[model samples]
Target: MTEQRLRALVYGDVDLNLIDGSAIWAQSMVRALRAAGCRVTLVLKAPVRTGRLVDPLTELDGVLVRHPHAEGLVDGDAPMTVPQAHAVLGRVDGDHPHDLVVVRGRAIAAALAGDGAFRNRLWPYLTDVPQNLAGFTPEIHGDLRRIARAARTLLCQTEELRCFLEQTVPEACGKSVLFPPTVVVPPELADPAPRTANTPLRLVYTGKFALRWNTFEMTGLPTRLTNAGVPAELDMVGDKIHDERDDPDFADRMRRALESAPGVHWHGGHPREKAMAIAAGADIGLSWRAPELDASLELSTKVLEFGALGLPVLLNRTPMHETLLGEDYPLFAASEDDAVDALRRAAQNPDLYALAAARCRAAADGFTLERAAERLRAALAEVYPQPSVAVAGPPLKVVVCGHDLKFFTRLLQHLAALPGLDVRVDPWRTLSEHDEERSRELAAWADVVICEWCGPNALWYARHKKARQRLIVRLHRFELESGWPQKLDIDRVDQVVCVSPHYAALTAEATGWPTEKITVVPNWVDVAQLDRPKLPGARFHLGFIGAAPSRKRLDLAVDVVEELRRRDPRFTLFVKSKLPWEYWWIWKRPEERAHYEALFRRIAASPSLAEGVVFDGYGGDVAAWLRRVGFVLSTSDDESFHLAPAEGMASGAVPVVRNWPGADTIYDRRWIHRDAGEMADAIEVIVKGGRWDEERRIGQGQVRDGYGLPRVRDAWEEIVRGR
Candidate 1:
């Protein structure tokens, strides 16, 4: 049977006629949600006009648009009046009831706060800081609190705002989700046009020229660049002023500045598409705003739009800008002079400008329509969870229970991508540590429960699972050696998954489970994220990851580095792991503590080993770390699937696996070595004979083709489906 599509209603006090930020947001959001399989209905507070040249409703595909009217409610106001609430409620109740109702304005949020009927359906999208609400009354605050308490989710524009709301309104702590402004690039500007050396540095500003945005500096920017000996031009693609009712003289002041400034063209108020087209040809984008207003916590839609067009933005140096673009980003402007200097630098070196533009484009990916849709879908799923069982042609409900989320997060992502599967995670930090009720709830919600490790989580589900639910437990090398496997209910579990065939055989022997129940499923790796350009001196650098237990054989890694140092002094071993003493559990074992201490002492005593080894403490940036590593060394005594080598291989690094029990089964025998001497010989031959590149390519290809997310996901799908 076909499943029912989700229904969503997005309403706000936004003007559709004006081609402004709010209009762009409404259009993009409606389109994005529609694209994510949602039947969206957009309700605007203002009345629909027929006199306009283009209808906004016609532009937004698959979205039903409505304009509901109230007698006394103004466009932007707090504490919604009684008539306003009645008008909105009447419209919703008069029509088909929506599964989700997204209120964009605070007034609208207030209007619906008291309605218990819309509580579960309400999702308040607070664009700005609630603290910044103008004419903030005690009544409005009460309404906000009520709305926060009632709404299923409170959507925030930025993480800063989310954190602020969580702190200020503690009631909204676990119910907020970040829904940043997204950029939708047209096909023409999808891929950035490369800027040439001789092209004049064309800077484009495409938003309201308000005083708050520092329109005065924008007008004089072109002249400043020219004075700095850089051939530049500025294109201002927006109105001369904004909020003219409050500041009537601001437009005239801006016009006077623009008229006086040379090499500045004011093409005011074009359609968003036309403006973006103009922006697409520009070398750089400008987003210099007044810091005193302190709206830095809010993400600038202008920056994201510019990035979507693949142009590097010349933004103000603020915490928000630093968060979006890195601190070391070349185009940050503190003053008008700083902006000029940045433009001059970019104009002088086209290569530097290209690099900066590329970085901006890459950063923009996180705020694209697709990414926003994914986040929205995930958020909605949590609010309105799918049922565990279907009425007919049952869809699979998979519950992934795990102790460590490091490996299982990737697997969960893959499982979520599969068709006809409703997957959820039940993570416990340790075997014994878990919410018993939550674990049982998750187990009850599943057709198949997969325990990531054969630990307490596995046993917990085995004892608590429903009669109809199938249980599958995975056993890594360490789990087989541990006593937990013996305690597991072998009769309750339908199958056992192992990382490799060797581990599968060993697990069956250890647990005395039927051989027919054991199967192999390799670990999934994100090949796309790992496939990055290797650093310049990476070829000579050997890397070791995860040196926690004494069994990892850090001493063996030292021996390999020492042997490599004899051939070439440039060879260095970069250990990307935590020191043994850093883990409190490792220090509890006297023998393990003594072994690690003795190894550290030996390294300190030996000048060659100490000089050759560089210990980079535990880091979350494995992709960045792997770029500096040319060879990934797995010197473990035993591993079901040592992911470090596979990750390294995906990052264009060759794998040098020490022949543990399951190492040969997971990795190619050509890369696996019998001992430290053979490992050194293999490294020497590969590096000296120029076979490193070939080996790197082969290893990377193997990982991408074999252990990639798609292949691993397919394997899990097949096993769960009883194929």
Candidate 2:
């Protein structure tokens, strides 16, 4: 890398020396640039005449030089006298001899307007202010147009912010880059005084409160925590908005609500430092950036600051937090009871809290001032590479196949993570029956196609198409074992990415496809946070998770329980199926229904072995239930990486799985049983040997180490980038 010094002129509402959003951005930006080995000069618009040479400049980590320029027209960093501002800009331009001129607002438009030489590489950092200001004046409109045309880069806070710019300033669409706000400095943090064994956990929330400041209604996490008596407090550090306080009708309603709330405190408007000071002593930090019409595109500095202070945060689930804290932090419920339960859970298990805190520290390491500077340096290098610059159009078009809402949504989320990829998914539902026009149009628009069509005729139609677009077809359980579709249809697919290598081989053998074209990308479940709760009593009970009637074979489960009952009547079955009645629904005719009903009625009525099976239907914590079950039995006839067995593996359950067509290989040894009789034998062996705990320990460790999302995401990134 070559050593290059870059000067930056930052004009915004808040001063870094002072406090607020603008300050955070400028301070962090300056620190980041300096760490990137660039000398930065921050230009601000405070009155220079009224005061003696007031040093508006404050150094951040000794890397950034903050200069407060005396701006006369607008007291704040807003549009001012065009030519006068230009004259000031010219003076700064001449004095600095900077490589890049950073313009944040219209106040410096004249300075940027005069000549192409000066305006050529203007990088304006927009903070979502352009869209919300009161009236749209001619000068404001003209200044925005000029900035859009003249600026080399428009650094936005979010994709939502970028999309807004695309719609409002159509011409500046290609130049926009999403850059969320970040912390410029690590706050002073200290470990809380050690609590007594019987002491309640201390939970704290510190931030602003108002219509735009806090999101009290949307996320009910705080409410849940308070109700559970987890010793929580929502500390409102800022004064409520004027409208909320002065308006009698609104103020009454607000006070009544706040007063009714038990564990919340309104500490009305403390100094920024004081608020942070109060936050430093808490065990758990609450950094929820309340959702606002304008702030959905916003990432708060609070969460980052909390992390820097070594406090594990319970954040609101937003795109901004999701991006920065990816697998580095934990999130909690937005309800009162949930928050309380979360605190209770944390208090009961210090290990979890400690792990979360460690992760928070790890996240802070990556989000430090130096790291941010590196990111800023890279962004600037991309925008102002060498001396020559040319704006490039959006790169690569990404077309996703299968328009089922869930699949497409997940696919879009993953694709969205990769920058510069234009993504669009064809709504597959409409084409499910047949629609030539829509299908061809979708194929025409896509540069690369991903289709899930299994029928041979459909693949043949796609094979004959004229387009040279690369095709990727994904196959899971339905396509692997279903007799409805023949294997010859797969020859039309260019490449196949299956959920499991076992299934891939099974499909290739069944379809008679060459092995080279098939790649196994195991069926991935988004187990983003799959850690199970510790329940000691979970060692005795046996369980099975899943609802498919024929595939799961509930009958086999009943038989296994009865057989186990013969050896030891204490062996209970905990069936974690979504629905018990759905087992009978699979039968079409009255005879089939009657047979299922008779068997179910007999099992329900029998006092001997039937009482041992308890059907605990759908639950929130499936993984936890898995922990509660000592032996996980999956007697399925067909499966594609059955989730129940996988979850069981995650939760330390000894998997008594059948040699189902697609899932037989998930076990450590060769599946010894293909039929229900064999499954009964396996269950009996597990119960008699009393080695379920050991099996569970080995299985959970294997899954946690190999099949978790981090490993899967790395695999996915490689596939997407063609690495």
Candidate 3:
């Protein structure tokens, strides 16, 4: 077989051999490349006297250089007074020529690429480096900006980094490729099975000795596993390097936590292979990271390595794994109880572990060295694919306006993602008492004015303009519900778009405008590629997928679930909404927050609703939960489109919507029924019938065809272009 030809140089300021996450990261990438038949070369400014090569011993396999005087330095920039560091890097660039030299540190990487010779070959790879006021020194900022502009390519590990880079250096970020964290699993290394029913299960955590790594989550989990007659031992490996270790005072709380925790061993630090071998022997590896860290949103190398070693991995519910991996995995827990349950389940079901191992291997292959190389080469080849001709005219400058800040912000993101289209969003979500001044200022600068629920402001802009460029006003549920017309000057406005025909009808009725003047552009939920996994025996589960108290009517949902439970003791209600756990102070009083907590507990405890009422927590994955239920219910008092039911219907759930005032008097009556009673009846009927799944499948097809993104995008384009 022919060898896959590619070269990678892993250079950074941190000691590559240090027993830490950074060293593990450097090792994984290098090992992955070597396994894929790539000509791998690594460069590090190691300590002058005892410069030892890091894990995988790739230094010996490839090329290793030692810097005599660069020891004990955190930075490699000579301009910053570290002369030996710069000398070492300069020497590496001259002697060992390669296809790509991957630099990790921001400043040093930028400084290296600043040289014309290195600029053509250097690829700056950002490993989720946090940018804060403390770290934002003038030199660091300058080098980052330089690297952002000069490097032939930039690689980011997470979406957060991509979002951050776009804000910092948007133009340079356009050339960047998001190469998410991955693992390389050799067949021999990954053959070990997780602890089975006959033997004690071994649980492991191979990460830095920090609370942020969520060592605390593992505290009580081991107890649950042990109580279930599954002997569970939790072993924690990989402590902070000597210099990198924080003060003992930093872990004061952890010390207290360990006092009460049992069957948990905190091994300070160990060699790379030792840690990996220990991990390979474990049943499951914990990779629960604090969500606050933007870098943690990507799958950690620890999680990947565990999978590479063929251990069933346990993770918290995070975007980190979801975006890269699938929904069905061995374990995903948020709290201690959930951790216990997941642990016990994994311990009992060896087959589940085998399934997870298979998926993990598949995931590992998806992010192999060969795949990473292909992604890099493909991105580089297309960096500047367009010809350098200057005959094209200036790009269109578009300005979108909306009353609700969040609504406008989401719209802005959507517009920004559209390439070759110059778009600027004037977000007036924070309209002060002096909004008139602000609106006028923005009005003058805008070419195309998109007025969305901007009531008086929209009217003001309409009265001021003669529709020279374009003036569009979008009517939402609030505009119709409040009995307020779109409030735009019809003579000056070029287009009027209602989120739904019902909203448009309400506006037309109030304004005495012709129906022809208003265009119906329904809101859409993008579920083209959502995972709609069917849960076994999920027939009696009722799902409500929204957070707002008014729109969702949680109290009404509770009543409905109580009514259902009275009829069928097996019925369960799954309320999928994110709790304000981080911002509990907003509840005003302990009693108020406690009341909600009790409500959640009640739902979780009921045999019908307890395990059934999974607080699926905030975000777009509601589709997954929706598929597990026989019926989808929404008791919204009012809405423009009521996306929850629409989304639920799209996920193969039988939608039961309440008949609101807007639904009765709005445009058409295709979906909404009378009330929650009617919704409940519809759900009961679906449960009684064995055709609920088939019905929902047909409905899903209907939603995809009618209210999909492309359909909505087309309507939006027509409205904006005055077609």
Candidate 4:
């Protein structure tokens, strides 16, 4: 095993047998946490019947699902209610408690947040949180404060909710992390491009068939739109119908309408994926909720699912929706009349569906399964911090040999501080050669030797290392193309680490090493140290960290800044990197010198870029420097794993990356741009609009989820310990 598997206990108060949103959320939460490398033990709040939803979760490795009734927590099929479940919390905790306890109910969270056993390992995510000043009573504030102060993180479903929590409960200021409405996107969309408007425009709604969901009004769409000369139909998929005392006939009216309506179809109920497929088959998605929910800050999961399937959604024109889909979104509806009118208008102009689809696609990209996994991964990192080692026996001697340890410095320090080992370094003079006497002395004394780079240092160790020693090699971007990996005797090395999967495969092909022998561990970013509050004037400031040797594309950044300033003169570009002259290898080439010189001339020649472009001196205090940056740019032609932008994101700056290969996999696709113009366009929308605060906060969580130091540090230590 690799050190120790991350242990997590997830308790969501919902019946997993149903297709409700809360039920689906529990299922998706389990999947996301498992994807983040957790060995989860999920406890159900209610008894299972068909166990349909639990099937998918059981298929996942390192996941254990526990039923409340089967465990005797409840008498029979009766639910283990909040208080009932709270009594058995210790039983679920076991002898050695799970590293993280995720409680989903507000009352249960308040009950367990300050418990001695849970300590700082409890992560509480409540949907019933008060949203405004009117809702935040003194008693409620006290309850929220107790939970926030004791819990590791207060998970929020929307930025608006997070802001409200911070304002209403002061203790939740730094503890809140956005866990936005998560959706499972189809691997390939049913339709990539929008189809021209046609007759029988199909609209689909999936979830509870409730009055507030406006499903009853949706049945009238076909009649109203057909009379308006645009034929339409409605597909309603769900089984749950609440019995309201105030509105006793709501369900009966819905059933009679479905049975008698000309074009409305009712699918009883289906699993999440099946329901989504049904929605994907339709022309438009119905998410037009009642006016009562408009003041709520939570984002709609159904809207995200519809968008994930590439369907245009009909939603209420609330502030939350406006910020997500933009104010110009064509399908904003407030009532049944507004919805019918919007559909009629869209049918007349097919281009509106195309625009709506684009907007929906953009907004949904940030709430995907991958993004959810990343967010969960980051949240878990806080609960399981890197531990300072305590020696149990004779220290195991370990040494790191490399010419450049700049990238390995943080990791090296982590190992050196561990109490179990006597750590040392054998710094090589160059890539291929080392001081033979010093290297030999270290090799004899070391039980584990780590080659920081796949250069001569690794090759030499591969040929001469003792049989009992465990030698590990780490390969980077340059080593793959430089032919150094092919020279190493890979059989001698215990493991070869690569920064990414793309490079890992390339290294395997180059070395003919066994596929199982290689692992992809991303470079670590110190998220805890880097994440800080943004400066006051940072809204207009753009930052680019390494613009050197022409490939980093200083010219392209200048072009983007020029376009941005033309639209808004408040935009500025701050370039933080060493000048080209500082690198002798780059300056020795005349083309490199000419490229940088020309870029400098262009920036000075342009009226907009003259004062707008600032070149700050390079320094190690990047976290401190990133305070004044609002946006971080990656305009390079290519990259293996760009830590600069991840570092920027860790420091609460939005990332604006060029669509390099696999760029979307590393970060959210919403941040990746096709060209300099698109990058500028995206940035302008944030600065000129009201989404900067929310956008940067999400970025901060995204980067930590991807490459935070603790997760990577754990992976590296396992390789070193040969576990």
Give the poorly placed runs of model 4, Cα more than 4 Å off: 186-197, 387-723
lDDT score for residue 38 of model 3 = 52
Writing each residue's lDDT as its tens digit, candidate 4 over 529-634 gives 5675565679899999987868888788888889999888989999999999999999999999899888888878888899899988776556656878999999
On lDDT, the candidate that comes out on top is: 4
Q: After superposition, how far is residue 586 of candidate 1 from its true place, in Å?
A: 2.6
Top-down TM-score ranking: 1, 4, 3, 2
Candidates' TM-scores?
0.63, 0.47, 0.52, 0.58
Model 4 per-residue lDDT at 168: 65
> Ten residues in a row with the worst lDDT in model 1?
48-57
Q: In order, what lDDT does every prediction score?
A: 0.78, 0.57, 0.62, 0.82
Ranking by lDDT: 4, 1, 3, 2
lDDT value, candidate 3, whole model:
0.62
The 10 consecutive residues of candidate 2 with the worst lDDT sum are 48-57
For candidate 3, write residues 335-398 as lDDT tens digits: 6677777878877776777787677666666666667656555543333122222223555456
Judged by whole-model lDDT over C-alpha atoms, candidate 2 comes out at 0.57
Measured on C-alpha atoms, candidate 1 has an lDDT of 0.78
- Per-residue lDDT, model 3, residue 525, is 55
TM-score attained by model 1: 0.63
